[model samples]
Structures are given as structure tokens and as C-alpha cells.
Target: MKKRLIVGISGASGAPIAVELLKALRDTGIESHLIISHGGACTIRQETSLSVEEVQALADKVYAQVDIGAGPASGTWESLGMAIVPCSMKTVAGIWSGYSDNLMLRAADVTLKERKKLVLVARETPMSPIHLRNLQELSMMGAVIMPPVISYYHHPQSPEDITRHLVGKILDQFQIDLPQFCRWEGEPHV
Candidate 1:
């Protein structure tokens, strides 16, 4: 059977990461179940030409952010793992505190409790003490708190290239490595 992954898009600055990840997931034939927050929806609108409905259309299934009773909100629902691409601090705090205020957080909470892979692509740059502490708390609890740090060695020529790298790293947390990303050898690719 095809692998299923839960994708949560928070209202973080890096909307491209989610877009590329979804595209990659589709290319790989990995079933994606998506949940997006209000902020995430706004970010998608602000950052991309794709409408919120268009983004949602990329996924095999989409869950309303407010639906805490969604299938993904329960641990019994099987999945390879879940990733919050461009994870916002609000989402981070919610997951860190086990504060399932919405479907995204609730699903992430369930992912952690079920010992499934839970990757958070935290997007804030100037992280405050609260952010750091929350990240630490989440990391300690076994979530992969990955920041969208770009690797310059690849010498990416375009935004899409960088997005591919970020998407690759995000998917890597779930052991889903796509060949579209550049892998650093002993030296940088020129």
C-alpha cells in the first residue's frame, strides 16, 4: 500500500516549503492528508498564486483546521508520520504544551502519543526565549524540530531549487527521500 503522511501548514513565512513538499509527495505517490490553519491559509494566499482550495486540492485528503474530531485527530488513524511545514510559533507552542486547540495541533499531538514520526519545520528566525524553550520541550518529547536553514553549498540558481532542498529535508524526517534534491558529497556542487 502507498504510504500516508499528514501535512500541517501553519501560518509561517515559508509557504514555499509546504508547496514543494506537497508536489514532491505527489510525485512520489505518497498519500498526503493535509490540515491548514487560518494563518497558513492567509500565508498561502499572500505568498503564492495558488488559492487555498488549490493547495488543498494537492493533497489526497484535506481536514478543516477547526475539526478536532477529524480522523487524524485520533491516534488510531494510521500514518507514516506528520510534518508541519513552515511551522509557526503559535502552532509550535500548542504542540509543545499538548494544547490541541485545533485539528492540526490535535493531529500532531496524536502523532506524538502514537510514537509516529512528527516533524516540525519551525520557520521563525529571531526566536525568543519562549520559542527556544517550546522548541526544546517539543524536541525532548521526540518531535523533530527542523528549521528551514538553506544550505549554500548547493549553489541553487532559483527559489524553486532552494524550496526543493527544504522540501527534501522536511520529507527526510519521515524517511521519504526524493531524488529531486541535491545531496552534498564530500564537497559542494558547483
Candidate 2:
């Protein structure tokens, strides 16, 4: 089977990051199986010029959020792992509570049960105790809790640059080196 990865997009502010990640995955020739929540569809409309269909076009395959019987919902579907880019707090809670109400959540649950890497690009600030607790528990359960934190050392000049940097960092978790990602080589020599 070809190298595949499941990408989930939930409602969050960083919809562009998800878009960039999908583009990067396409550029890398990795087959992306995508599942976007209702909120994700809305966010893509509000935050990006491209429609949700355009974004879905970037992936090798797309699954409807309501389709719980999709290929990704099964552990038998081989994949490198799954990344829920711009994961909303609600989605985090759903996954933490083991509530597989939709394909995105079900795929995440399967990723965990299969002992595959599940990266949640948690998008929230000033995380409340409830959110933190959920994240902590999810981490304990072997899911990576990645936030869309910006790095200054890279000297990002625009929002796209920042988004690319963040996407690169997320890709790093899957051991895929994004060519544009500026890695820290240590403190700049004086």
C-alpha cells in the first residue's frame, strides 16, 4: 500500500494551517485521507478563500464527517497515523471521553486503539483546567497534544510563513521533514 496518513480538521482559528499541511502532504506524495468536521467546513469558509471542496481536493481521499463507516474508521486501514490539525476543544473532549460520534473522532479512536501516532494540533489559548485536564489525559493515553505555537527564531514574515512553520512542526511529529521548515541549529553565534 502507498504511504498514507489521515488528516482531520476541526473547527478552530488555524484553518489555514490545515490547508497548508494538506498541500505539503500532497507535495510529499503521501496519500492523505481527510475528514473535516462541520465546524471545520465553516472555518474554512470564513478564514480562507478556498471552499471546503477545494481543500478536500488536496487530499487523495475525503470522507464525510457523518460517515462513521469510512475507511479511516477501521483500524485495519493502514496509515502512518492521524493528525487532527487545528483540533477544537470540543473534538479534544470527544476523543478524550472516547466518544466516537463521527468519522473524525472514530478515526482518532482507532488510531489510539491501533497504537498508531495520533497528533492533535490543539488550537486554544488560556486553556482552562477542563481543557488542560483533557489534554493531559489524552497525552497519558498516548496521543500527542501539539499546539499551534509560533516560533520567533524562524523570523516568520507573514501569516502564511507562520502557518507553514507550524505545519512543518506538525509534520515533524510524523517524521516527515518539511523542506521549508527552518530547524533550530542552536543559538546564533555572536
Candidate 3:
């Protein structure tokens, strides 16, 4: 069977990461099922030249946020794992509290209940005590909370480079490899 991955795009600042991740998955022959929150769509419009439909077109399948009956909302759906790139604080809180108000949250909840890999790329600045606590709760609940911080050791030359490194790392969690990923050999060298 083809490897299936569910990708969620939350309303966070780093819309570029989602686009890169989608492009990488598409190139690698991974059938991606994408879910985009309303805020996610708004952010895409704000940050990217690609329209919402254009972004949706990146995935093999796309589901509405309110579609509770979608395939990803169930545990029986055969998927490798799920990810919420640029996961917003609201989205984070929803998953941390098991709030299945939308398909993204429901899919994440299902992923957690089924013990599948659920990667959350939380993007926020100067995390408050509440953010830290919520993130801690998510970590304790078996979710990998990635903040998308830059790894300066890679000697990134452009915005695209940083985005690729982070996207590659996210895909790495699902055992998905992309050659564009800057793999850290050991120590930084000139």
C-alpha cells in the first residue's frame, strides 16, 4: 500500500514550511491527506503567493476543517502518521485538551489515541507560562512539539534553506527522507 500521511496546516506564521513539506512529500510519492484550519487558510493568503486552492492542490486529498466524518477523523484510517505544521497556540491548546471541534483537532486526537506519530510544529515567540504548560501537557500526551527554531549550525543561506531543514526534520519523524534536508554530520565546519 502507498504510504499515507495526514498533514494539518494551522494558523501560524510559518506558512512557507507547510508549502515546502507538501512539495517534498509530493516529490517523494507520498499520498498526503491535508487538513487546513480557517486561520491556516488566512495565513496562507497573507504569507504566500499561492492561493488556498493552490495549497490544497498540493495534497492528494483535502478535507474541510468541519468535516468530522472525514477519513482522518477515525482511528481505522490507515495512515503513517499526522502533522500540524506551524501549529498555532489555539490549535495546540485544542490538541492538548482533546478538543475535537474541527477535523484537524479530531484527526490529531485520533492520531494520539491510536498511538501514531503526531508532530506539532508550534510557532510562537517568547512562550508564556501558559504556552509552556500547554506544550508540556502535549509532550506528556505523546505529541512531539517542534517549535521550528533555526539550527544555525547548518549555515543556512536563505529562507528556503531554513524552511527545508525544518520540513525535512518533520518528515524525518515519519521516516520520510528528502535530499534537500541538511543533515548535520557532526561539528560545524567552514
Candidate 4:
């Protein structure tokens, strides 16, 4: 059976990361259920040429932000796991605090409560102690706090290259095989 992935996009600045992740999932022929928060939609408009509809079209399935009744909101939904690419601090706090006011948070909460992998691509800088504490709490709860930090070892030369590099790393957490952006031999490049 095809693995099901629930992809959440929040109001974080790195909307391209979310888009690239979705595209990579599509390339791999995985079924992606997407949920974009209101702020996420605005960021997409600011960051990419693709319209909101175009971005939503990339997903195999789409759920509204307020639709807490969606299938992914329950552990019985039988999905591989959920990822919140470009996860905002607000959404992170919601997930950490068990605030299921929206579909994104609800899905993430379900993933954690069900002991399923919930990868959070936290996209914030100059984080306060509060943010750090929340991340720590989530980590303790079995959520993968994957920040969108790029590796310079890849020698990425463009924005797209950086985005792909990070997305590849995210897929790694899911154990979803994809071509490596840059291979590491644990030694200096020949």
C-alpha cells in the first residue's frame, strides 16, 4: 500500500521548504494529505509564484485549516505519519500544548498521542527560551523537532539547491528513500 503522509504548512517564512517537500513527495508517488494554515497561505503568496490553488493542487489530498474532523485528525486514520514543514512557532506551541483548534494542530496532536512520527520543521530564528522549552517538551513527547537548517557541506549554490537539501533530510527522517543532494563520506571531498 502507498504510504500516506500528512503535510502541514504554517505561517513560517520558509514556505518554499514546504513546497519543495510536497514536490519531492509527489515525485516519489507518495500520497500526501496537506493542511495549510491561514498564515501559511499568505507566506506562499509572498514567497512563490504559485497561487494558493496551485500549491494545494500539488497534494494528493487537501484539508481545510479549521476542519478538525478530517481523517488525519484521528489515530485510527492509518497514515504513515505527519510532517509540518515550515512549522511556525504558534503552531509548534499549539501542538506542544495539545491545542487542537485547527486541523494542522489536531493532526500533529493525534500523531504524538498515537506514538506516530510527527516531524516538525520549525522555521524560526532568534528563538526565545519559551520556544526552546516548547521544542524540548515536544521532543520529550516523541515529536521530531526538525529545524530547516541547511548543511554547508553540500556546497549549495542557490536557493532551490538549499531547499532540496533540507527536504531530502526531512525525507530521511521518514525513511523515505530519495536521491541524495550531497553525499558525505566523513572525509574531505577528493
| lDDT for each candidate structure | 0.90, 0.93, 0.92, 0.91
TM-scores of the models, in the given order? 0.95, 0.97, 0.96, 0.96
**Candidate 4 per-residue lDDT over residues 1-190, each given as its tens digit:** 3498999999999899889989999998889999999999999999999998999999999999888898998889988899998899999999889989999999999999899889999978999998999999999999999998878987899999999998988888888877765767798677
Candidate 4 at 81: error in angstroms?
0.7
Candidate with more favorable, higher lDDT: 1 or 2: 2
lDDT of 2 by residue, 12-100 (tens): 88899999999999998888999999999999999999999999999999999889998899989999999999899999999999999
**TM-score of candidate 2 versus the correct structure, residues matched by position:** 0.97
What's the candidate order when arranged by decreasing lDDT? 2, 3, 4, 1
| lDDT tens readout by residue for model 1, 13-64 | 9887898889899999899999989999999999999999999999999989
Model 3: how far residue 82 lies from native, Å: 0.6
Better of 2 and 3 by TM-score: 2
Q: Give the TM-score of candidate 4.
A: 0.96
Stronger candidate by TM-score (1 vs 4): 4
- Model 1 stretches astray by more than 4 angstroms: 188-190
Candidate 3 has its poorest 10 consecutive residues by lDDT at 180-189
Best by lDDT: 2
Clashing pairs in 4: none
Q: Rate residue 110 of model 1 by lDDT.
A: 94
| Alpha carbon lDDT at 64, candidate 4 | 97
Residue 23 local lDDT, model 1:
88
